[model samples]
Structures are given as structure tokens and as C-alpha cells.
Target: MSSGKEPANGTSGTVRRRTSTRSVTLRDVAAHAGVSSQTVSRVLRIPDEVAPHTRARVEEAIRECGYVPNLAARNLASNRSKIVATVIPSLSASVFSETLTGLSDVLAPEGYQLLLGYTDYDDEREEALIRSLVGRRPDGIVMTGAVHRETIVAMLRTARIPVVETWDWTDTPLDVLVGFSNERAMYEMVCQLHGAGYRRPCFVGSLPAGDHRARRRLAGFRRAAAEHWPGREPRVVDASGHPLTLESGARLLDVARGAHPEADVLVFSTDIFANGALLAAARRGLRVPEDIAVTGFGDFELSRMLHPGLTTVALPNATIGREAATLLLRRMRGERPTTRTIDLGFEIRRRGSA
Candidate 1:
């Protein structure tokens, strides 16, 4: 029977009794498992701190009694909080969200909780968030975009937790990293555009801002243009990648149109900018791929659905997350994890737009 009432958890609806009569506590579980309170604490806080037999006994007791530890209280006793934190510059794009999905998928089965923080592209904010995450002393840390303040890098080096940096790659990594080649991806796109008969192309999007990945892509794009075209380097407008938004795309369209009237193609840093370019081009009465060809990164779903589907660089967002999380878990199990970086693959999406 369904009731419109709520339980003693405090609601105006009907209530149902819990399946178990007794509230499961750490002490109760310890007693049932024939272990001391201290042992149980050790088992929960740092399972590796206890012997295998003791851990098994504690876990068995937890399962049998349906015991749940108070996370807040448990965190205070040990340095390891058993929580994982992922700091993203922004979660607005489905790309980051998908990455987050992968992270959670891997962590959930291990009985560890994942926490999220958004720095909104502010370096100072990132520094602050890093401090907070460090204070919690989580078992693992996953960060988006490898660019970090020196203090944050030092902190991660000292925190001694399993750290996985994702979304972008550099020759050096803080620890384990799962990412795609942002610079090379852009380089490949630029070469493709040139071979496709784009003699005068202009790159659009925000400056790297505080984002090292976007900057690298920009650098690669410029390099390709300068190398292939020689004296005809593509025109570029640097928007701030820090507060990256679709609105920046509008500005990009105007800037490209005004500065490089001879441009036959425009390379945008992301789908958001690409979409804006599309709208701006339409409003300016320019035909896509005819008067002006547009290309974007991060082949989001909307890229295909739009008129004259956007040609873009597709990043394996979910795959990066899954791989990063998996790596962290392996490290947490005391396995010696090698390879600080994992470069997931990406591709160029050819569409009607370019």
C-alpha cells in the first residue's frame, strides 16, 4: 500500500517502520565482529592499517547489521576521510559532466564518496579550493586541466593521496593523468582545414585564460598556421578562457569578420564558440562553409543537430574520467601505479559547417 504520508524522518505523510529495529553503530558492529572500537576505527579510517582478518570481520559485521558510519565523525578521527574531490573550472559544458559521470561510476563500487568543486576559472578561487580539499585529507584527488598554482602542485605532492589530473596533458603530470592531446588535436584540425583549401583561416576563442589546455590548443593552431602557410599565419582573437561562455562566441564572430575579411575558415576553441559563430554568421547574412566555414572543439551533441552540423574536434570526455578514476582506485589498493599520463584519443568531426 502506498501512503501519502512521510516517516518519522519528519513528514506529514503516513509512516512505515524501518526494516531493522536497532540503529547500527560502530560500537555495535565492533561488538558483533569481536573487535575493539579502536580496531574498527582503524579498519574504517585506514583499512590498510589493520590486518586482513580484522578488516574482513569488521566489513562482515557492517553488512550484517546494515551499519553506516557517520561520515562527519569518522573524518575527524583519521587523516583519510575516504572521500574523493574533483575540482573543475566549470561544469556547464556536458563535457565536464560526462567526465564527472565516469569518475562517479568507478568510485561508487569502491564505497567511496565523490565531492565536486567549481573554481569558475579563477586562479585565486582554485588556490582556495585546493586548500579546502587538502584540509579534508581525502583518499584521492582528481583535477580538471593540469594547470595548477605552484602551491597547489606542492600541496598535491605532499598530500600523499592518489591524485589523477584529467582533461588536458603536459609532459609532466602531478601524478596519474588521463587526458587527450589538446594541442595535437588542434594541429591536426588546422592541417585538415589547410588541405581542404582554406587559404585564409582565422582562429577564434578566448585566450587560454588560466586554462593550460586551451592555451596549448591555441599554440598548436598558431604553429600549424605559421608552418603550413608560411607568411600567411591565420588571424587570431584571444578571448579570456577563464570566464569562458557562449556569449564570447558572439564577440568572436564580430572580431573575425572585422579583422579578417579575407578569411575563408574560422577555428573556434569549443562548441559554445562555434554555435555563437553560426548565429553571428547567419545574422551577418554569410553562408556557412561558403562565405565563411566554422569549426569547433568538443563535439557536443548539439553540434550535430544544428543546421549545417558543426565540424569539430571530439574529445573523449567520459573515457578520460573513467580511466582516471580507475587509475586512482588501483593506486588506492596499494598497487604501484605507473604512467603519470594517459592520452585518450580524439577525432575531427567533419560536417556541413566546414
Candidate 2:
């Protein structure tokens, strides 16, 4: 038979534990603060309107109970989400990280939250993310690039929210544009290298499919190379895919070396790739700027610190993010900007590597 003695209190047999599974509500906070629910709500929404003592009590109760306001409900009631959605290619790149940080720094001060999404350079994924972000009813949306699928463009038009596209420029943008022309920038970069007497240049970059920015750069590179070095076909190597990592860069460099060993100047789509090519050249016992000249786009910090310092196109990553946020914030406040496009141009950093 079972021992029928009910566990006595403090007898080390059994203890009754009360665990409240219910979520803390406004009424509970009001009860804890010894105030009406409306007073608690006022304290949360408009603290200055509530008496100082009441507000303090409500705040204390909130802290004690770890109360978190339902943002969705609040947003519905206010008809303002106070959220900005940003979609970029990849967070693995430091440029995108810097952009995000710049956006957060500006938006956080204005009581707005940033929701981030990564597309990994896929148009379909970008469209999906845009759809999801639109469903959240964000106050504004910031897209990384201007190039989007037709469906994405149509959705953006239908959503009717303030949109800012960065990283690349176009004559026509979805809404506000805050970026330099990748094509022109790369074209000018090629001119710079050519002017510096580095002939026989080759463009090494990812496959021209989802990455429209890289394709634009390649187009610029090809045009510049054809005009500068006639009769010699442009040595374009599709290192292929989103090879943003150093290992991928190194492997691509190996491919480039085997294909175009005569290339004196190698223009990479990214600094990470250039850095990898630099290491690959070192491993092959080749001297930088002597045996080969290395250059890259997006002057990452490593590009500056590397031995023989990588020559690269220095893009204003942080500025793009900050400007995009500023534009969105202006629109969020019911202010129309004088200009829809802001071309924050780039510069070519010439170093020993080139």
C-alpha cells in the first residue's frame, strides 16, 4: 500500500511550489502598482502625463514582474510599427556589417528598431525577404542593391513604403537611392591602374548571375580594358558563385593563375579575394608588383594592413547605411526629400601592391 501521510510542510517529504504560467498583463501590473490599468498604460505610453509617484510605482512593478509590452498590439493600436527593415546580400562581409551598424546608430536614437535580413545574393530570396518584411508593416525598408526581380519591384510599388536602395546606383531607383555607381567606379579604377602603366589586366570575380554589382564592375572593367588595351581580349575569369571567403578567393586565384599566367595586373571583385590572391602569389614564390600587381574592390581593413598594402576601390559603406537611414527617417516623419538619389562616390587607393 502507499504511505498515506500527506507531506508535512518543512518536513523534507514534499513541498508545494506555486509556478505562475500566465503571462504578465497590464491588469497585473496595475494591481502590483496599486493603480488603475489606464494609469499603468498612461505611465507606459506617456510617462510625463502620469503623476511622478504613480509612474515610479508602475515602473517598479514592471521591473519586478519583468513585463514586456506586446509590440504587435501596440503597433496595431498606434498604426505605426516604428520598425525599419533592412535586407542585404550577406553579413559575412564586413562592408555589410558596417552598413548595419551605421543604420542602427541612427535609428536607435529615434526610438526605431531595425530588422535585418540576409539574401546571400539571391534575387528569389531577396523577394521572399521583402515579402516577409512587408507583412510586418514596417515604417520603412532599406534594400542593399537596386537590382531586384520584377515581382520584388512590383511588391515594393504596392507596399507604398519609403524604400532606400544602396550599394549600387541606377538612373531609375525603386524609391530613394544612396550609393555610387559600381560600374563607373570600377571603370575609373581600371583607368587608374592603366594610367599607372600596369598593362595586361584581368578581371577576377564571382559569376555574373545573382551578383549584379559584380557584373556591373566586370562590364566596367571590360570596357576600360578594351579601350585601354586594344587587340588583346579582356581576360575575364568567372571565379564563380558567392566566393566571399578567403579560401574561395585562394582557390579562384589558383584557377586564374593557370588560365591567365601572363596577366600582370589582377583586379579582384573584393578585398578578401585580393588578399587570398596575395597569399597564393606568396606561396608560388611570386613577388607582388614585380611578378604581378594585385588590386581589389572594397578597401577592407585587411587590405590596408596587408604587406605591400592592397590597392582597392574604397567604398563609403558606413556613409551609404547612414544616408539610407536618414532618408528613410525623413520619409517616416512625413517629409519628402528634395532629391531621390544621392551618389556617394568612391575612390581608388593606390598602394605598393599595384
Candidate 3:
């Protein structure tokens, strides 16, 4: 029998001494810097409190020892997580990606980090995400869209934290608004198409059960079409079975054309779907803008690169994200904006596709 402290024998009976690999702590950095633990804390927390030479020495020691501060303990002491929670429909989409990039650009410099969640455009999932995020006690919260369940709205209201509702315009914002009018934008899109001599235009998109914004846009288009082109029945295709993809767009356009053979133009809810529709038409030996005109929402990168250059509505995705982050930062710092609603409107880009 060997003592626990004795060197262990290897496979060949060669003696070997074990070494411990413990993480370097604050005390280690302090010892290496020849300073007290309090001084080391001050250097990290408020470098201005320490002399320039002392701060430099402590920083060098920290690097030499690879010392890392315990953020958990620090957060407990400061009562701040320095985290901003954001919940969006989906990150796979460029709209949300752009916004997230904008938020990170502004928040990173201020020592704030983003905690993200996806709701898959479901109200119940969003409610669950909200509950989970609120439980984390983040410094602020940013949510996409104005439409939320009553329980979600009530929970956010009761939390008393700064909340920002983005990507849609609403008079009764949960806290702050950093978005545009989806209804007005779609209405204007329909009017734009109608102005260009498209009398029989049909709307194609997913069902209302998943996307409330799409439903609102569809309503706006219907209202505008009724007012502008009365006596002509509007055509709508329920493409809700599949995810909002180019393939779905292609399939839905085929169905819409079949239902309304006289339809001269197709207005898609998104550019990806419109691209699919364009491909489908091309496959059927149809000439774009001559045989049938097509338009889409969200002027994403793919829209610009398309053969005919798709005519779509350009949204300020990154700008919305940056503005939302700025507003949250201001609110966190005890500053209030003169107005909470910041409407960054959309623009209709005319292209060969329409």
C-alpha cells in the first residue's frame, strides 16, 4: 500500500508526480502585482481610483497570471447582470439578424451583453420565453412586434423594467416603440402597384394563425384594393401549411394563378417567396413584367441580385435594432425620451420585376 501523497507509478512502474491545475484568482493577481486584494479589486472595478503606474502594474500581473474575475460574484455585489434580453420571431431571417447586429454594435462598447431567444412566431412560445427571460432579471428587455398575449403584456408591465416593442407601429406600446407601420406600408405597396396599371393583383402569404403582421398587411392590401379597384374580386391564397420559403412561395403562386387566371400581378409577403414565384413563372415559359408582374416585401440582398431586380419594400432592420438598443440604454441610465414612438418608415423600390 502506498500513501495518498506519494508519487504514483506509471504503466512501466516509473514514478510520476501529479500536478494540480487550479484557476488563477484575484488573490493570485494581487500577490503577483505586490498589491493588496482591495487594490486589485479597485483596479478592475474603477481604474481611475488607482494611480496610472499602479494600474499598469496590476494589469500586467493579471495578464501574467491569466486571472479572471468572477462575474457571478461581481454581479451579485453590483445588483446588475449587465445583460439585455431580446426575443424575436426567428434569427434565421435576415431582418432579425440585421437588427441583432445593430444592437450588438451599440451595446458591446457599454459593457452590456445580449441574451437572445426565438419564439418561432408563436404567441404561446413568446409568453414562455418572456417568463424565462424575466426570471433571469436582465437589465432590459427587447421584444419583436406589438401583438402579444394579455398575460405577456401584463407580466412585462408588472416587471417595471424598460421594455421595447420593435418591428411594428402601435399607439399602445408595452413600453417603447422602435418600428414602422406594417399596415400602412402594405397599403401603400398595393397603391403603388395599382398606380402602375395593375388592376387585378393578388396577395400571397402564410396564414394568420402564425404571422399576425402578415395578416395585417393582407388586410391593408384588401382594404386598398377594394377602395381602388372596386367590383373586381381580390384573390388570396392560404399558403400556411409550409414554412415561409422560396419553395412555398412558388407553390402558393401556382395555386393563386390557378384560382385567378386573370390575375395580372402577384404581391408576395416576402422577397424569398417572390423569388420562388418568379422562378416558377420562368419555368412555365412566362416573361416577367410582360406576362405577369410580381412584387415582394422585404428588399433583402437576394432581391437586388435577382435577374429582373425584384421590386420590394425596403425595411430599416439594422436601424431599428440600433435605435432600440439606444433607447434601452438611455432608460437604464435614468433618462427618458421625449417621445417613445420612433417610426422609421419603409420605402417602395421600383424594379424590373414589377
- Residue pairs clashing in model 1 are 5-13, 5-14, 6-13, 206-239, 207-239
| Top lDDT hit | 2
Answer with 1 or 2, whichever has the higher lDDT. 2
Candidate 2 is scored at a TM of 0.89
lDDT of 1 by residue, 82-126 (tens): 789989988788889998898889889777888899987778899
TM-score, predicted candidate 1 vs. hidden true structure? 0.80
lDDT of 2 by residue, 1-354 (tens): 968653332233232222486786777666666678899889878888988887887898788767788988989998999899999888888988999888988999888999999998888888889999999899999988889999999998998999999999998999889999999989999999889998888899986467899999998998898899877789988877645788877787778778999988889988989998888778888899898899999999888998889999999989888888899999888898899999999999999899
How far does residue 50 in candidate 1 sit from its true spot (Å)?
A: 22
lDDT of each: 0.82, 0.87, 0.86
Q: Show the lowest summed lDDT stretch of 10 residues, model 3.
A: 6-15
Candidate 1: where are CA atoms >4 Å away?
A: 1-68, 75-79, 241-243
- In terms of lDDT, the poorest run of 10 residues in model 2 is 9-18
